[model samples]
Target: MDGISDVAVGVKRGSDQLSTYKNTISGTDCMNDGASNGSDSKKLKVDAAPPSRVLHIRKVPSEVSDAELIALGLPFGKVTNILTLKGKNQAFLEMGTEEAAITMVNYYNSVPPSVRNMPIFIQYSNHKELKTDSSNQQTRAVLPAVSTVPSLSSDNQEAAGTSPVLRIVIDNLFYPVTLDVLQQIFSKFGTVMKIITFTKNNQFQALLQYSEPAHAQQAKQALDCQNIYNSCCTLHIDFSKLVNLNVKYNNDKSRDYTRPELPTGDGQHSLDSAVAAALRKDSSLLGALNPLSAAAVVAAGKVALAGQPGVLLVSNLNEEMVTPQSLFTFFGVYGDVQRVKILYNKKDSALVQMSDCNQAQLAMSHLNGQKMYGNVIRVTLSKHQTVALPRDGLDVQGLTKDYANSPLHRFKKPGSKNFQNIFPPSATLHLSNIPQNVTEDDLQLLFTNTGGTVKAFKFFQDHKMALIQMSTVEEAIQALIDLHNYSMGGNQHLRVSFSKSSI
Candidate 1:
């Protein structure tokens, strides 16, 4: 493959050169296009890209497989190769020519996107745009920090277009929707400004406000026909009907809107509780390491950043013994442990965030690879930088939101110093000695493109393991076949595999 090389060369160079290694630290390598040859191969033909062009696309789906990216991006021309970064939600679409790259960018930017559920941002990569000392200098144009939390108010800020928001009507409401449940469902839309439920005879009427009309419409679309608590508890949704609060109390629209089949405590229900049980049954589900208590893990992660508003990881604690929330108190001693993260499997391994760069440096100078919980507690900064603060910890809303708007919104440097190995494990992909030009996103995108339909993709805070999820198991096998010794971008061959996940 001409104009193509992968990570092996860079990984080897990195590990060999850096006495001070940190997966969290990003590196870059200028093109050493030594492998491009004029070959008559069709595979090479389909894969060959112009000797010198790069595509810059944003607002791509996170779940979109690397194959899909190739499919979507290749239309611009044989993408000699494409790369996306997991740290931020964006991709580096290197095309056959600057013309091709520019053509692709303008083509997409001309109209509303095909898969876009939200607004999209994209453009060409100008060399002069890059900043100094940053591994991800290519897409260095500042973007909004990753945030998916829907707005809290329902007012139509947009006097124009909007997505639909689901309309919900509750029937057998023995109790009004609690704040916990309200936050759970409404937050998914954006943010909830207000929720009100009134009851007279165990039956309740409720009004829910979502950030956008589209979100309300979507909620109505999916949940309208679905049951709420269980199969026996059917839910009714009304989209066109809203009580005219301006007029006197009205009973017609409210009652006719929907009906619920109430339960008679002793009655048998058809729904199985199996799904809930299954999720709870597996404690080692998320990744190799159990994440610390949601609250604590986020706090430690935040503090590790030294006041930068972003997500954090906690390490150096066992799920079987101590609770992640409790262990975070110890991190608080270092500073405001914004968030704490515990690995699902790497017991005692944790990640913590401080309030500012100085604090993060303090913890790093004092705590990198410190021993704790029968294992060494690794402490370092995180790469999940964001321009704006997220709505909350856990990064759930942020990750989803980043996936929606633009893939580039995914990475931010608010420039917090990234925490390296808070919990370094023996079983990990050791990528180092990278030319100070290689980036975490570059490495991740390489494997994902070659790896097939990545089901879930994550760069391990740094580069320990880029956990991949495939559309099907077969793609994983195929990726393995094609990747053995195959090289890309920086004269580097990739290390690809299917192993234990973040769990």
Candidate 2:
């Protein structure tokens, strides 16, 4: 330990100060060498053991742990001990034998190892064995190296390469693949830093960033040409020229896994208020709070809309059930539907282009995550401003040729009254003031004749309120206008508005 001194002295300090400490220890060693008497005890034989089976790592992240270091080395061979110089962001990892150390060094020396995206330089340590002192032992949390950090090395170390970002394109998009779905898929290789989903050339495209390029390469190789669900969402992968992805919004399309949020349906309530509401009412009330009508919620959500494009990314359809006409039948309710293109490479997904962003936003906020055809669909503002149909090939045949002036469009239809009293459209409509004995079929019949097509109908547990998912935003708005304050039965005045939940 001649060149090393006071490993514990600067454990809580930074790297620059630790360098100065090392210089001081070097000066002390030189002085001791000059002052030493010619004693036989000080002399050692030349045939001492070679360097120990330890690898020295430098430039590590300060937050990285002993367990993480063990995880890194465990793939090559058994790890014997770990010494962490916390403040300096360095460590010495001792493997079970010198051969193990050589294997680790030769492999990672040409390509460096990384933890948390920070590249770490590795070399052989001179020590024959790590010293286990009480102070150092007390400071570290040691675990057997047999276990692995699933996030770090689910694949071989060779796949944990140097680049950190990957660009992924869905060749065939049939499933409703959300940012959450991509995160779940790519995270097995390494820590996923960020993911951004958008539509390019009418296809679902995404950018995924891992902590290291090797992880990205591994994920790309494993998932390329793989289907997300039942051979529909085929993945096409490549290395991004950019080293990292910049994510500014935590919206439907972009997610940074370094900072993750709660699931999709759980955003309506705060922690304290949710508990309070649960205590006040039955636990069922804790599911999703609906204080305002769906129209009001849609109106509120519009203020945050980027107003970027008419294109909408639709997800979560049953590939077995969703078709170009089915998408048109639903999205056409909100605005003049221009075109519908079912992505050939993805399962249960399609692109619906409206005449304007207003209609797209109206449709997105209302119908997102609403049940249709036995599956809940998720809709979001696509990064593409419009759906550009392929100029050549059979894909163009999937486009809706005459959607602009189609009779199916609510406003363009003959004698359509929706133009005068247009509320912000939503798919889920809230209906209150219902008679206790009234059934779902009765309410469905009332709306189907005037409001629009009914996709789903469900009464609240109390039977006084219900949520109805109309086929389109216009229908929900028409129903809201027609039914608000209308008589139901026996002094009951019906109150209807757009609902927040599509169920």
Candidate 3:
């Protein structure tokens, strides 16, 4: 079929005959114009060689193991052999057939491949096949005789009645995997509807549900046995027996993205507490906390005092320019700011109440020392548990504002990417949701009106997102405060946030 031989047929070609073949096949001939050293040693590079059974990958991360390299080819077809040139950070992967290699090259060309967050380039190699000495020790370790590729395609799964839920178990748990990490990785394939994580039988396990069974099958085919980190925290995924997951809470342990109004549970502790308890119970559970969980721990502090009360005292504001609405928009980046009350008598100070204790702690930790309206503001937990509203007849001059029902809350939805993208104010701002009609000049002029010099501007390839750098961090903050959620002549509202990247 399609001139592609089956893997079983390739295996019968005899490894002994293949081993005697020289390893002089050129991997970069397509790009280098047929130049070769005529030696086995070669530096693999991106090429546009004619379709073959082998593919060349460049810029591979040094820590990448054999399994990770194999995973790069598994989703497309059977990987019969692999050769990693660790010293050169390159690898040559041999698929079972030329058609499979062509499919892999096309798919990766569109999506790209990355290991440990480092982008790698892939292309077809001139070599029709790989011939490594089967007797070599390193070859034996990295090359498998034949990989058991999953034959369950989307069509097959649909006919078999596959479930939308996937059961995940993390083996070699050297890192604390949080719900946010899982969501970020899996959501790339589809819309993750819900997730629930817990430890069972002294092993960390999770149940994740996709919006469709096809999405689950695709994710399973891609991520099963893939390492979340360098060589640890490998994911072992399978179709769950249940058709769907029933998530009850929108907390660190479990989340339901479709149900944003769900409570964070009555007495739920942060994810760190659960991980720590598991570690105490089993010494083998020792591992480092990921950035998301570490940030949560640092924000919430000790488990005994993890409940930091949902009120914050913010001071040293530019009273003339500060308003409850401004504070709501600024602090909403971390969590939902429920109510904001600018103290009438002390116009320089205000009390901001968040949706919950965890949100308050997060807002305080991230915004404590940020600049606002030309003033370095200070944010700390207030003794008051909540911000009190004005009396019925008291004329507070609109200083006291309640935003409990505001539609601009960034973290209102569970498993939001915003939760992982929180950064301190910077000179660079990320602008998204731009209308197709909005041009660069329009955005440049809009920010210039805020009295800040637009140093540089860049629109992403899609044109819907961009990065604009201001003259200073304070200017960027002021621009963000003024222009965030501003309408751009269409139903779409502009989304602005401090970016860790620069144009």
lDDT of each: 0.36, 0.57, 0.68
Q: Rank by lDDT, descending?
A: 3, 2, 1
Query: Per-residue CA lDDT of candidate 1, range 1-503, in tens?
Result: 10111122322232233222223223321122111121212111123233236544445555443333433333333333445443344445445456555555655555444322333334544331222235443232111111122343445344212422223444422112332233333333333333433321223334554545655654444344333332212345543233111111212111111111222222122112442233233222111112221111111111122223233444554445444344333343223445444543464554455544544443443334433333444454465442233456755422212211221110123322222222211112223223335565665565468545544555555453355545544454344434433454476544443342342
Better of 1 and 3 by TM-score: 3
TM-scores, all candidates, are: 0.19, 0.31, 0.43
Clash counts for the predictions, in order:
115, 20, 0
Provide the global lDDT of candidate 1 against the true structure. 0.36
- The best-first sequence of candidates by TM-score reads 3, 2, 1
- Candidate 1 vs candidate 3: which has greater lDDT? 3
What lDDT tens digits, residue by residue, belong to model 2 across residues 1-503?
Answer: 11011111222232332333332222211222211332223322223234568776666677765545555564355555566665445677777778767766765755467665556666666566654444334322232212122344555455445457666766433224566456545644555677766643334567778777776775666555555544344566766555666555556666554443324322221123332332234211112112131111111112123234788999887888666766775666566788887777786788889878767865774467566665667787776767776766656546434366664465565344443223334678777779988888888998888737999888889999899988876566556555656678898877665444557
The superposed Cα distance between candidate 1 and the true structure at residue 226, in angstroms, equals 1.8
Candidate 3, residues 66-112, lDDT tens digits: the string is 54665566544457676666555667788877876876787677666
**Candidate closer to the true structure by lDDT (higher is better), 1 or 2:** 2
| Candidate 1 residue runs with Cα over 4 Å from true position | 1-167, 173-176, 240-503
Please provide the root mean square deviation of candidate 3 (C-alpha atoms, Å): 22.9
How does residue 279 of candidate 1 score in lDDT?
23
